[model samples]
Structure formats: structure tokens, C-alpha cells
Target chain A: MLHTYLLSIQDQDPTKPLESFGEKLSYGGQMLLLGMATVFAVLCILWACLVIFKMLFHDLPAKKTKTADTVEQTVTEPVVEQTDDGEIIAAIAAAIAMAESECEHVKFRVVSFRRK
Target chain B: MLDAIKNFLGTTGVAQLFADSNWWQYLVMYVIVGVLFYLAIVKKYEPLLLMPIAFGMLLANLPGADLIHLDFFFDDYYISVEGGKIVGTLANDFTQFLQAIPNALYSITDSSIVFDFSEATLASAGTTMDAVNATFQEFLGNAATLTDGALHIKMSHVIKEVINNGGLVDILYLGVKLGVYPSLIFLGVGAMTDFTPLIANPKSLLMGAGAQLGVFAAFFFALFLGFSPMEAGAIGIIGGADGPTAILVTKELAPHLLGAIAIAAYSYMALIPIIQPPFMRLLTTEKERKIKMTNLRTVSKVEKVVFPIIVTAIVCLVIPAAAPLVGFLMLGNLFNVSGVSDRLSKTAQNELINIVTIFLGVSVGATANAENFLKPQTLYIIALGLCAFIISTCGGLITGKIMCKLSGGKINPLIGSAGVSAVPMAARVAQDEGRKADPSNFLLMHAMGPNVAGVIGSAVAAGVFLSFFA
Candidate 1:
């Protein structure tokens, strides 16, 4: 079965010449036109499909952005803890100092302290 | 002892070369092999494939090393079988039939024969089995009738012969002949390829298609040079700038020219850096080259996963003949982008591709024996192959210029040359030229869009040829 198939591929003898130069030329021209045309058409269709995909999936990244904003909000909220009042005051002062050092123009202060 | 020494000397390769009339051909082949080795090892021009191919050529040309017998594959060799018994050889020509009959009889009876027959009787008879059998009956007088008019030689018989009598390379060559190795290589290529750039910018696909201008151009030129249509089609595919695609097409359309076409395709591909730059510069102005366009949009994971599926469906539907090459290619790509089959993807990308490359390179190299490679037409194929590469670069550049104009100078004309499908190499050349025009202008990612698209484009072009001619 394998040999039969291999032989079938070889059946078209490459040595056999066509009848005339005119026929060869005509065939060559036709193939050139047909080959180029088919390639362009197929790729063009693929291009159109990609364009549609972009449109369909356009909103996905935006949804991802909304989730990212919620994560940011949760990260920025302060955590409450049972501790000494003095320790809390000292922690706030150190945090303000670090923030002020990073941004030289900004001044930070503790507005209020509560035990929770 | 003296007689034994004489016999040994008579069987040696040196003795064979001295006795053969065409000894110079072998010497020339050796020099060609040496040059290829120098290119592969010293120049570092696709060393992985070129080294194996060069060595295979050397092995084939060795005087006394009967590593491959081209006649077994060529010459329309066939055998007829009847009721599971080996019958007579089926050859259209009387001379070939007569030459093959002895072997056929030996395979069947497992005994030697001393038979006499007049050539005049067989020559006068027609080539049909009935006519030949009648002639044989007259010679043997009472021998049993042979054959059932089935003309094909069973592949099993050929495989048995290869295992029993053929060389190592012959066994390996079956993969190339059956069109298995190239497609498998594409599978690996697909696993390694990233279609993100192409997916991000879909317009690059048109540039890829435009770059195929050289494929048809070379086809027409080859036809004018007196190659048969099939041979021309095989030669023309060298323009695709993809070696496996060229090899698969050539093996199917013109197996005899595989060696020449393969060598030409690879050598020209290695020379792309030199061959494409002049055309890229000649076709596009400085202003056009410096045009750094907007960045490609980010392709979502969902789009990446769906890209290969859509391409495979549309391309296979449009050109069914392209399915083997294109289907395997997309399958490989899917394995890569799907992100689920990491193990299968890794194996295809590394071990599978490497093994097939060695087999494909060497077997394809084995086809370049003295008679096939040392022809005036080989020179034509080499020249036409260079022309194909140059024209393809120009094709891409021209399309790039048109796209630049149409998009109101938002596109860089330099990126067009990447559509010739030399992968990242062609794209890098575009980036280099673009940077020379303006240091800050980056075209690598932009050019990659067209570079990957060119891979698909060339595969489609190969399918078109197969559909028309195969």
C-alpha cells in the first residue's frame, strides 16, 4: 500500500515535456495569476476575521482594569489592631516621616487615633 | 595468498575509481562536498542541516560504497503478484523487463536458472503481459503461466528489499519520499512559533501574500527555460524561503530535483541578509524607511488561542491540498498557544524537530548524486533561486510602500521585506535598516507580524501548486 502511494506520486514524470512552448507559457501565466490571487484572497479573508475578533474581544481588557481598581481600593484601606495608644502614635509618626522623605514637597500629619 | 591479495585489491574503492570512466565526477563531487562543509562549519551558515547534508553527499559519492541505488526508486520499477505468489516483473520496455525477470524468478524460486531466449522474439511482441507471457511460453515450451495483469509493485516488497539489501540512508529516505519528515518538522516549527505579532496586526497578512510574487515569477522563468511544468513548480517554490515547504513540494512534483532545489533554497535562505538589504534599500526611500508606525494592539489570550483554529479552518477549506503542511503547522501552533499541553509542545519544539531535521537533511542530501546534482540545470536552479529571493524581497517592499501610502505614512515601508518568511531574520533585517534611518525607530515587533504571516503565505502558495499540479 505504501509503495503504491509512493509510485502514484512519481507517476508524473518530470522529464516529459509539454507539447509546445506556447502551451507552457500559457500555463505558467495562468498559474502565476491564479496562485497570487488565491494567496491574496485567503489571507484577506483571514485579515477580515482577525478584525472581527479584535472588535468582539475589545472590552475584555477594560473589565480587567475595573478588577484592578477594586484591588487598589482594598490595598489602600487601613488595618485596625488591638495595641497600646503610644505604639500607635509612634507608628503613625514613623509612617509620616517615611512618606515625607520619599516625596520632599509633601507634609504628612496624624489627624485622629481610635482603638478598634 | 597472492591470488587472495589480487582479489581483495580488485574489490577495493581505489580500484573501482581507477577502472570507471567517470572518475572525475566523483572527484568534483568531493570538492563540492568540501566547500559545503566549509560553509557549514567555518561560515556558520545553517550548520545544523548543511553539515548532515554535506556528509550524506560524501557518503553517496564514495566509489565502492553502495549506500543508495537511485535506480531502485527511479526507472518505473514494478512487480505483479498473484494469489500471494510472486509473479513476473511488469516493465513497459522489453529491455527493462528482460533485465528484471531474472531477479523476479530468483525471488520466487530461490534457485538459479540457466535460460536461453532470442531477443528478436520478445522485441517483436507487444509490451502487454499477455504478449510477453506468450513469448515466454514459446521459450520455456511448457513452463507455468505467470502474472495476473496487476501492474503495481507492493510497498511491502519494497520495504523488505530495503531492509534486506538497501543501505541505512535508504531506510531513512522513506520518510522524505512518503512526505512525513517535512510535515513533522512543521509541527515542531509551529510549537516554537509565536503568532502574537501576526494576531496583533492582521494587515500584515497581505504583505505576506504579496511577498509570494517571486514564487510565480520563478515558476514562469523556469518554464521558459524548458523545465516541465511539474519541475518548474518544484523549482519555483524555492522562493517561498521556507525549506520544508520547498522540500515537500519538490519531492512530490520532481523528486529527481530534490537535491538541487533543497540546496538552492537553503543556501539562498542563508544569504537573505545580503540578498534582501539591497532590494529593501533600492525600493524604499529614506523617508519611507524611517516611518515608525503606531504600536500593535495587545492580543488577548483568547484571540491567541483562536488564531490557529481559524487559520487552519479557512486555509484548509480554501486549499485542501495544503492541509498536510498547513494543518500540521497550525496544530503545532495550537499546542503552543493553548498553554495546556506544555509537555507535548516542548517535545514537538525540541526533540521531534531535531530528529526530523537530521533525517530530512541527510536523505535530501543523499539525492544529490553526481548525475542529478552535476547538471547545467542545477546551475539554472541556483540562479533562479537567487532571483526568486530578490524578487520576493522587492515584492514585500513594494507592498509595504503601498500600505504606507494608503495608511497616510503611518506604516514603515521597511517592514514589508519581512514578509519573505525567513522568520525573525527577515524581520531583523527590516529593524536594522529602520534603525539606520533613525536610531529610535523600532520595527522588530512590527516586522514580526509580517514575518510570521509570510510563513502561512508560503505554505498556502505551496498548497496552490500541489492543488494545480499534484
Candidate 2:
């Protein structure tokens, strides 16, 4: 009744197994443990293969910029300040100055000097 | 005129019902059919299959109805198969059996020729009466002879029987008895499925595998409750939550239990939304439920094409008994993913599958004759089916929680409940619950991974059960 990776071959009479309750449960338990393990093993193999394939073929990670690296939490969004329009720059500067005036020690930068 | 009236009254269904001593069976059948009809129609619970099934149940259970009736070997209609050997199979083919012997019902004698059909006896002694002894002996040797000149077989109504008196449901029941319907249904399922989600996240395969814990668990419970192992195997498959698989396994293992087992399985499938949520919530934290799965990576077209072939090779090698259902399922998928065979795929999913589904549902439903479906065992099947379904969802959710923990909160535990193979229905329930937790979260595509995995997992489970006899 012990479940193993190799497929167990049972040629017991179908009717005989039903005759004894303990024997049926033993059969049931064997199937349970073996079936689950087989399922997990098969799926895990596929998962591992997928991970390896992704690692070998997917685009390489982009270099982390100073601004992005400074962004402390994965939950936080990176602030970008790049624009061709003067009006957008003024709006960004106004917002940054407004926040900075409250906390004088705060420092900020326009990470991208080109048009976004 | 009075004699004609009496004869006509005697032939009427009402007259037959009145004369029948088993009136309670009729009453119970009517009530059961009525409830099934209400569920399939009034409540719209899997009406596509259930309504036909309900109607078929009604037809088969009616007193004096020819539909689904077993024509016993009485009235001198005799058929005996001795050791399943046929003495004159070449001489008495089914075609000759169909033609009623051309006014010459010949009997086999122990003579060297094996039949006494000489003109000497044909003229003086028609020999049909005295030949009964010889006929019975040859019958034991698998030569079927009818003194009444009707084609005699056990549970096999011939083409002539169909032309004369066979009902439509009886004709359809052949599909169920021969075990063709479930595999055809799988073909339809394959054509309709998109396995990208599964290919994208193979880890969900474990969730599908985890979900089958219900199947094994329920099997032990059923056996403990004193069901025969075959009967327990049928009941246990309900935990797989795939209607076709349950029906197929029930048909193979315990055909007498098919009607009850199928109805219980499909009823639970229809009620997946109601049955799954409480377990999903009970098994996981709000934080785990709210976890958003990363978007599935797009699978290459080549991968989709290769999947079915690989799965078939691996699974069939392991459990050959599952090859028919799983093979047809993968063939349907191949027809779909090949992209050049839209017509083939459409036919499999829509036309071919639909035709088989009608036969499968009605015929399987017909087997719930009053003598079978009215037992306390039927109630137990229903109760155990519900238990299996709930516990299966729990199994999936428990696995999902573990995966969620291991994946650093990327995997949503709610998607675990989708591992039961009720198709998009189980996935939809997960989606609906996820939306309630976080409106921005969409769990459908992610849940689909486990949903479809449940299908493959259940088929493998069925194969494991069938391997015993195979």
C-alpha cells in the first residue's frame, strides 16, 4: 500500500477487494498518496521547465537607474519629470517646490533631461 | 363493438397503470422527474443536459412504457450463452437472426452437421416443439434458437426490434452502454479549451492535482459507508467535478450506478458557485485572497500544438485506460490549436459533441429507473457527492494558500477553488469572489490555469482507478 513513484501493478480480483473493508481502504489510500504525488511531480516538472526556459530566452533585465534604485518600496511608483512643454515643467517644478518648502531638507532631481 | 372497446382499454397506459401492483414506484418516479425538471428548467441548472435527462428519466420510469424496458427471455423467447462460446456463429450471423428465419426456425442437433434441417422432417414433423431440447442444448453452446422465431438476445434489441417497437431513448441508451458518449464529450471540451493559461503557469497543475484529494477522500468515505468498491469508485469520481469524467468512470466501473452518479455529479457542478465560496474563504486569509497573480506569459503557437501530443504520450503510457477519453480530449485541442482546422475544431466542439451530449445525457438519465433511483443509496450518492465537491474545493484552496505563501503573495488563494473542473464556471466563481475583495483584480485568466489543470488531473485520476481492471 506504500505509494512510490513507479506505477504499481495490482491484479487483484475487483470483487475480492470489496469483500474486505480494510483492503479497499488500503487500496484507496495508496491511490490517494500516489495520485497526488504523481500530479505534483508532473506539474512541478513543467513549472521548473518553464522557469528555465524563461530564464534562458526572455529579455535581460534593464540596468537600474539611480532614481529607480532610490525608490524604496516595490509598492511605490517612480516619479518622472521629463517634458518638451514649458507649461508641464512649470507644473512639475511648482509641485516639487510646494512639497520641498514644507520639508527644507528634501532633495529632488529631474532624472530624465530628454522628452518623455 | 364491446369487445373492441375492452381490448382498446386494456392497451391504454392508464388501464396498465391501474392493473400494475407497483404503483408506488410510479409515484416516486414522477416526483423525482418533476424535481429534476424544476431544477433544469425553472432554476436553469445545467439545462442543456439536465432537461433532456429529466425527460428521459420520466420516459423510462413510466409504468408499461416500452422505453428502456428489458425484454426478458420469457414467453418461450430463449437465449443461452454457455461459457460465452458460440457453436454456430458463422452459420447464424446477426443478419439471418434479423430476418426471422424465413418461416423456418431451425434447431441444432448433436449430429455432425450441428443442425437438423432436412426436408424429410420439415414435411412430416415441423419439429419446432420436440426440437426444444436440442435447441436448449445448442443454445448452451451459444447457438441462439427461438421457437417463436423472434431474435433472442440478452439486453440486445435488434434492428428489427427498433423498427417494430423500440423507443427513441432505448436507441440512445446504446451510446451509454457502449461507453462512447463521454469520450465524444471530451472531444468537444478539447475543441473549446485554451490551454495557454496552463502552459503559462504549470504550478497550477498542482492545484488541480491537489483538488483531486477530494476524489480519493470521498472514495474512502464511500467504502466506509458500505458501498461496494466499484460503487465507491463511481461516487469518488464526483469529487473530480467533471461531469463527463464522472459519467465515463461510472459507466465503466458500476454501470448500474450511472444514472444516480451522473445526476449527482452534474448537480454538484451546477451548484459550484454556491458550494465553493465558503470553503475558499474558510481556507485562506483575506490577504491571501487579495493577492494579485502576475500576468500569464504568452505561450508560443508551437507549444500549444505540442502539448496534447506530449500529454497523451506521457499519460497514456502511465494509464492506458485513460487514453480514449484523454486522447480524444487532446485531439480536440490539437484540432483547435493547429489553427488551420477551424472547421474541424468547430465540428468537434459544436456539432459532434452536441450530438453525443444529447445521447449521453438522455441515455444516462434513462437508467435512473424507479427500481434503481428510489433507493436510500441514491440519497447517499447525492449526500456524498456534495461532500466530495466541497472537500475538493478545500483541497485546491489549501494548496493555493501554500503556493501563495511560497510565491511571496503573488498567487491568489481564491483561484485555488477553480481547480475543480467545472470549466469556466469554477473559474468564474473565483473571479466573482476576487472582484468582491478587490474590484481592480481580475482572476479569470489566472484561475483558468487551475480550472483546465483540474480537467487533466481528473482524467489522470480516472485512469488510476481504471488501471486496476485494465
Predicted structure with the largest TM-score when compared to the true one: 1
- Model 1 clash count equals 0
Cα lDDT of model 1 by residue, B1-470, tens digit: 99999999999998998788988888999999998899899887778888888988988887788887654554244333345333343323333444544432223223222222345433443244455566555543132233442133445656666777788888898888788998999999899888877887899998999999999999989988888878988999999999999999998898899999998998888778789988888998988888977766667778888888999999999999888888999899999989899999999999999999999888888889987889999999999999889888888889988999999999898888999998767887887788779866767778888998899999999998898677
Residue lDDT tens for model 1, A29-112: 777877898899999999999999898875586689679868887577565453444334434543454454358668556677
Write out fnat for all predictions, comma-separated. Answer: 0.59, 0.34
Taken over the whole model, the C-alpha lDDT of each candidate is 0.80, 0.73
> For every candidate structure, what is the RMSD over all alpha carbons to the true structure, in angstroms?
13.2, 13.6
Task: For each candidate, report its DockQ versus the true two-chain complex.
Answer: 0.23, 0.15
lDDT tens per residue, model 2, B250-340: 8778777888999999888888878888877778777777777766665656667877887777677767888888899999999999999
- Candidate 2 CAPRI level: incorrect
Candidate 2 Cα outliers beyond 4 Å, as residue runs: A1-12, A16-21, A42-116, B70-166
Task: Estimate the lDDT of model 2.
Answer: 0.73
